[model samples]
Target: MYEKLVELQSSTHEEATQQMVADEEDRRRGLEAAKLQLAEMEEKRNVSLLTPFLKVAIVETNSPAFEAGLRSGYQILQFGTVTSTVLASQGPSALMSATAEGVLLPVWVREEDQGEPRKILVVPHRWEGKGLLGCSFDPIRAK
Candidate 1:
């Protein structure tokens, strides 16, 4: 009878050890999945870093910017010879407003089809629209 009791105890101990091993394996798999998810998020962030700026939210019909072929979802890469990097750093509103009147503001834009940014000359004028440029922009991060 004593021997039978010892044998039962041994079986219980073995079962408990197996359960612990299974639990540890599950934990390891969960941690690995979390790491993979974090890596994917980092990759997306790095890709966005290449083009940092807001996309045009609106392009008023018949406006100068619209006449120049500007459209919504297009990213304004530059506000002239100045790169978006420089303009973005100085504040988009201030730099854009500082442009001299009648000076054809050369701009770089990334359209849907364009592989890289293309230069587009936009002549800002007080037209029948809401804003000076007749367009609205929202930062990518905001989206």
Candidate 2:
């Protein structure tokens, strides 16, 4: 009877160990799936961030905008905190309001040749040109 009891306990322990291993494998697979999903979501968000909202209509020579490497035909993805959503409700004034004198504002832009988006730091201080940026922007119409 003692030997029988020992055998039963050993069998029970083996079964429990196997179940635990299987559960661990399932958990690992679930974690991997969640990671893949999160990566996909991040990729989509990055792509959206690169979408252009406004195009640089003109950039004056020797101006703050030109000094910052802004060029005509470059599409503006984001200017400071101004995005397409803000432009939709607030117009171009939202972008102007985001700028401040002597402050370097980050602007995301894409070239007209469909290149990858790039970031440029622009200061809004007075320049030799008309506007603070010495550049003009035009809204990109949706197709």
The top-ranked prediction according to lDDT is 2
User: Against the hidden true structure, what lDDT does model 2 obtain?
Assistant: 0.85
**What is the C-alpha lDDT profile of model 1 across 56-137, one tens digit per residue?**
8898899888998888988766565444566656766655664555678866677755555665678787888765578777
The TM-score measured for candidate 2 stands at 0.64
Per-residue lDDT for 12-63 in model 2, tens only?
Answer: 9999999999999999999999999999677446745655788999899988
Instruction: For each candidate in turn, give its C-alpha RMSD to the true structure in angstroms.
Output: 16.1, 9.2
Q: Report lDDT per candidate.
A: 0.71, 0.85
